[model samples]
Target: GESVGLHLPTLSVQEGDNSIINCAYSNSASDYFIWYKQESGKGPQFIIDIRSNMDKRQGQRVTVLLNKTVKHLSLQIAATQPGDSAVYFCAETRGAGNMLTFGGGTRLMVKP
Candidate 1:
């Protein structure tokens, strides 16, 4: 079965440096991708998202990129801060929009 998974389970970065998180999905039919940030004891929050039609999308301090040909997705955080530390996940779903397959998640740690 096709599923989404992260290339790395953990990512460490400096408080003021940039961070990149990678994800791969096996389902080629998925048309939408979303990046979520989950803090301890809290639900995942939407950070950014990109449609399969677009190659890249940017929001505030975050960017999302999609490569359909390679079934790859990436999240880039600029000037990462302590508050930005969390578990990030990538989710994908078909056009139905009723179901979302999530990745294993990657833990982001920021060091001051």
Candidate 2:
């Protein structure tokens, strides 16, 4: 099925180290990319986002890069923290008023 998925299901990083999470999408028309962080028994929280027109975008402690050529997306966390441990998902939308298709997600574990 055409969907979004992560190359790595789980990523472990030492506290204070930078972490990079990768995701791939099958849809070539997806225009908006979003990164989400989900904790146990909770809804996904928005981390950052990038548009298809742009290759990269940065937010507080985080950066999102979009590679339209490969249909790839990535999130980079500047400093891993225990509080950052969660399931990270990449989602995409084709246009305004469209539903988002989310990846299976990668679990990020920040080890002390």
Candidate 3:
């Protein structure tokens, strides 16, 4: 038998601190990965993304890192704020027109 996915239920961080959320995926064929943030009662909002060809990518105060060998992915947020508290999800897609497969989300609790 082989593993197919990974999940984290929650994460807590202090205001002004950095946060790192992790995810693991099974599909080796998946070529694109995306991170999304969802506040309570709202749809998921795109945060950042990285292609399998690259190991890491950066945006505003966020960074996405992918490790294909172990099928791991991580999202780092710098200087977390109370407004950053939300559920974060990682999604994968292999080809055009393919629907994204989303990993179990991690709830980020930011303490003020």
Candidates ranked by lDDT, best first? 1, 2, 3
lDDT of 3 at 35: 94
Candidate 3 residue lDDT tens string, 9-82: 98888999999999998888888889999999999999999999999999999999999999999999999999
Q: Which portions of model 1 miss their true places by more than 4 Å? A: none
Specify the highest-TM-score model's number. 1
lDDT of each: 0.94, 0.93, 0.89
Which regions in candidate 3 have their CA more than 4 angstroms from the true location? Answer: 1-6
Q: Report model 2's TM-score to 2 decimal places.
A: 0.96
**Alpha-carbon lDDT of model 2:** 0.93
Candidate ordering by TM-score (highest first): 1, 2, 3
Candidate 1 TM-score, true structure as reference: 0.97
lDDT of 1 by residue, 1-112 (tens): 9999999999999999999999999999898999999999999998898988999999999999899999999999999999999999999977665488899999999999
lDDT per residue as tens, model 2, 1-112 = 6799899999999999999999999989888889999999999999998889999999999999888899899999998899999999999987678789999999999999
TM, every model: 0.97, 0.96, 0.93
